[model samples]
Target: MSPTRHGWITTPLTAGLIRGALDLERTERGLLPHRLPARARAQCADPQLHMAESQPSGVRLVFRSRATAVELDTLATKRVYVGAPPRPDGVYDLLVDGRPAGRACVTGGATLTIDMATGTVEHRPGPVATVRFTGLPAEAKDVEIWLPHNETTELVALRTDAPVEPVPDQGRTVWLHHGSSISHGSDAASPTTTWPALAASLGGVELINLGLGGSALLDPFTARALRDTPADLISVKLGINLVNTDLMRLRAFGPAVHGFLDTVREGHPGTPLLVVSPILCPIHEDTPGPSAPDLGALSAGRLRFRAAGDPAERAYGKLTLGVIREELARIVRERAAEDPHLYHLDGRDLYGEADFAELPLPDDLHPDAAAHRRIGERFAALAFAPGGPFANGSG
Candidate 1:
């Protein structure tokens, strides 16, 4: 254990768990130890041994799925168990030392129960069903879980085997982020594969992912979510969704962003907030509100296609990434004078020019998994580092 972080601590309080929701199985090793429980000494060798030290502020896993499976392989030294009633719709990943030890599987339509009192997984498979694992290692690391498709799941709680006390954070730093589906992580491999999650991993900071899928309309609710959440660092990726959805008029777009940011400022005051405009999207490059859609393809199956906007629409009520980018730059510049902590990151900095040269979006809307990795790396380089580039003020 590094002195830089505290020993594993268990909480009398068990944060509620999320069940049956679609979640992907993946391993994330870079979580800050603040709220995580320290790995147990007894069960350190099991590859399936996974633990979440900090109980209250546990990790959240979001994924798309229909039926899910999670597995944790345990060693002889430790036993994983259930702490609370399993979410009726979902199953608990066998947990050791407050972390994911193994996987659980559940189907829709029936209730799955974990008898916390008896330490067992019980199920009545019906229109739906669930499976759970128990008796796992306390110091486990590797974990595998299955989740349903096309839905989101946030893992809010876990229990651990090691015993310790909570430690208050001594540093004054915050992290904030914003984005579209890619940032929201649409169809990118797994829950951990989301760019925001990846960036949060490398940066080592609290992540408030405001990456809404097809919903980053600079909406007040979106901004309010950011404003209401505590943050030391902030970033916003705007535009593509706006173009894709044709949600607002150009006249209303710029000021709405300004207003959304203004509201966030009211809550954060001194926090550093970065506003990111869209990366290039050839489909919406010159396009306007009426983005071309393939209704015929839609009628045929799940296949859909799009084309660029009319130049005339760009002249009128159209929304283009280029146009929005120009406005966002101007807004940030004007606001920076009033707020010294404010920063502006060209979305292209995360993925522009050469990036587009290598990985063009297949549908001309969303980036592929490889692109998500590239963007995550670029973001880590430009925004997050040891000295705390994204750490608000003084590192």
Candidate 2:
């Protein structure tokens, strides 16, 4: 046990105790975990990228403790689109000895309100919210407090009746993955339940998720973030965001993919790298995108997305899931000839047509909680099984 803070043992929030976050900012109130570094954040002025990266998807506070009670102080910021129904507050999950022990939510904090139709933004401030968990086994065991994957939370403090010790590395492979919002834990049950998080558990690896929502547009900054981070295995799940934003055509995309890969190779030239294509989204499977929210559904307190592109635009070099997959597979094939450690994975294999019928993407763009589990299981079987690309370390 350590010195008491207000009658309870306390621990300083430090980088070593936080996992799955590339950077941590010492904010005025507390420490804030960020998936991207300061340099990468400085390169982008977009509010969306800032919000997504700040929402700690796979980030968690892990330690070894025997305390029967634990508490965390946080200042969480939630988003509220003026017209659309509000999303649920982010959930905090506690795992004891690698199994779930408790779950809770912060009651009060700040809010960011946006009027999308008018392009107006509003911020409302609030007080710190404390998430508490009691009734533990009262024996020494590892505890992992997974942050709310959908909320921007600043860690204020952590307190327990017993001292918290640093968790020794398990020598597991560290898997660093980057992708769109689906990879960002959208619509998933909670932080640890995100597909990538689940996949990491089943595959027995440490996770550093860079799955920024609506911001994975093959930006050089994001590629540079991936390049610099240390990892034992790496994968880039691309194409969805490019098509979702209707950002570019075939000509621009091909070179962008090559450039992103080239940047990552500069940091770890021989590390095994996997390129993943978009999963099956019926609306974007054949049609082009710039998917728009179903405003009518939103008026009914529902959230859904519809492709806003012209199907005929495919002939004009517009991109779709099918086209992206073809090009990604081709690119990996060509690159693998010279870079033996490079590989490709079809997202369809992760969530294919059959799986869709069984559990469809409720938002038409993001997978639901159950689908997240299914995809995680499938990914573990594919990538962690014998002879898989990431079976080796990132080195």
Candidate 3:
């Protein structure tokens, strides 16, 4: 059939064309993608988790279409820390037939400005913006629109010159992963370039990322979500968020890890499950946290994080990166005796002391774009290579 120049066809955004997110909520304006399902969201009242899950990290719209032009209408909620430099506009990455093709950005959207010192928040609503891509090959092809990883986007409409249909699964192994903001693409360039996305590309697997920024606190709801989601391989990067939030003591951490893994095993008894500790965060390695923003640096137009807890507090069981690494390794070792499919990867193996010496974390916390690339490549080789835990035919 020849391409038509008729009016744009509007398709309802549904699960068939969306990947990574666990649920979609119907809003007055459009569909909102959420990392956590409605059941999980209803159980938690933390504003942090609510905001993080809505950011759509590693989420994308995938379909087969012959459209020469596509336009997406979206309402984005972008965060801005008071006194910090304005963040660059979020990019929409377009992939056609499994190759990078084009990129575009939305102009206007709502803004949430937060005062770090006072814990005050102000919201400013902006109009919906349209992101359009043109001159796509006028033939049926697999298409993907990778949503912004950092901004909370409500997809209002999808308009194409030709009708779009969900792409059929290609029989690739599904890799479901959960972690903190680092896994959520904090300093990465774009959605598809996030470490997990990059690693997924290299490992040739379909990724469903549950990387909730600042919200990976071993929450029961998250573990339940993981248990219910189907996957050939699973990983949960633990520690940083728990320490930073100061949410639990060392005593609570052990049982939480076991409970999270137990719930997941109930559903995926034989699946390869990897437990990853946090990468080196210099500020929080020996020192425990409630990590606080470095107000001195922020005033000088730089953003940096600092650990507030004293090292002496370790005597009292405060958690730190060093302590977390030991605990995670011990847990995985003990569990592997009974569950052979279980494995542990010290995150430092992905970005260790030497790498840190050369490419130090720019903000004393999150890795820069370069570090993300290095970690992604290393993870692909370590976990997905032959004889490794996630090897293609190992199961």
Candidate 4:
């Protein structure tokens, strides 16, 4: 039962309604969403992973309520790179019974400024803000408040004119997907619109997104997390992060892929697991990277990225998208012989030259909102359509 105070009922925020997060941390402020479990987080001190896990990319509060008024309090921590353009306010998408209802944004959140060139950081404190929606229908119905995909948010409180409760499970297939920033909804309009979220909606499945911005570097802990998570379908989009971060060489990439899959198969031996190569990233397609910001664009008040590594380095075994794709395809083919449930999807097939000519990645990296929709629709048709690997009962 919800606690009532002066006609208003307060609901405790818990995992019941929160989607897309693997785990939640209770804090003095309220709850902090984490894509990785506590054990996984404790094993890695990488700042990229820390920031990515806390951003609440596909996390949302979903429930059924008859409340005419609802209010949520959040303490958000937003990022600011010294030379880049100011990011727009984070958006919260509200949906009623699977349809759009309203949208809101929290202001006055703390800011974390980074000097990318110097690797320095500064913190500016702000205050918690409230987002309220009034005039909701007084009839009990399903409601979802999707948190911002780009900002790290801490839920503080939830109050409503009528009590709210978790919506009972509807027996949807659960899809657990992991990838890089693009999959994390980097430039997607909102949480529900992220590619994985979009695909899940189109495929009629529950989503547990593990798309950790710049941290999808085949970490053992992440594989362990995937190993233990419950899911009816699984996918891992690899390559770009590994190349852009220049984290490993061609020699180590193959083994890492094998090890990651081996770990996941330990828990999900016959689960339909899809291995996706990197999408079309022209700059890093042939050239190796440790991608750097496009200072030219930055100077003109825009932010863009450019591959900074020499193309010649490929001869030395430095990884590139081209090489990664070839290797991933080979790896999948060899393993699929023994693991019939395993499958491979060329990322280029989802977004290749033809699509790039039409949609063009604005930042030379992440796709914009429109492209995300396109990819999501394509993925659903390819992966969930009849006879597809992820089709109902395929496993």
Task: Please write out the lDDT profile of model 1 over residues 121-168, one tens digit for every residue.
Answer: 554433313244445443323332323211322232222333323323
| Tens-digit per-residue lDDT, 289-360, candidate 2 | 998888877777777889999989999999999999999999999999999999999999999999999999
Candidate 3's C-alpha runs over 4 A off are 1-6, 393-395
Cα TM-score per model: 0.64, 0.96, 0.97, 0.97
lDDT of each: 0.52, 0.91, 0.91, 0.91
Per-residue C-alpha lDDT of model 4 across residues 22-76, encoded as one tens digit per residue: 8889998899988899999999998878988999987889999999888899999
| Alpha carbon deviation, residue 272, candidate 2 (Å) | 1.5
- Alpha-carbon RMSD of each model: 14.0, 1.7, 2.0, 1.5
Steric clash pairs (candidate 3):
none
| Lowest lDDT block of 10, candidate 3 | 1-10
Put down candidate 3 lDDT per residue, 250-294, tens digits, no spaces. 898999999999999999999999999999888889999899999
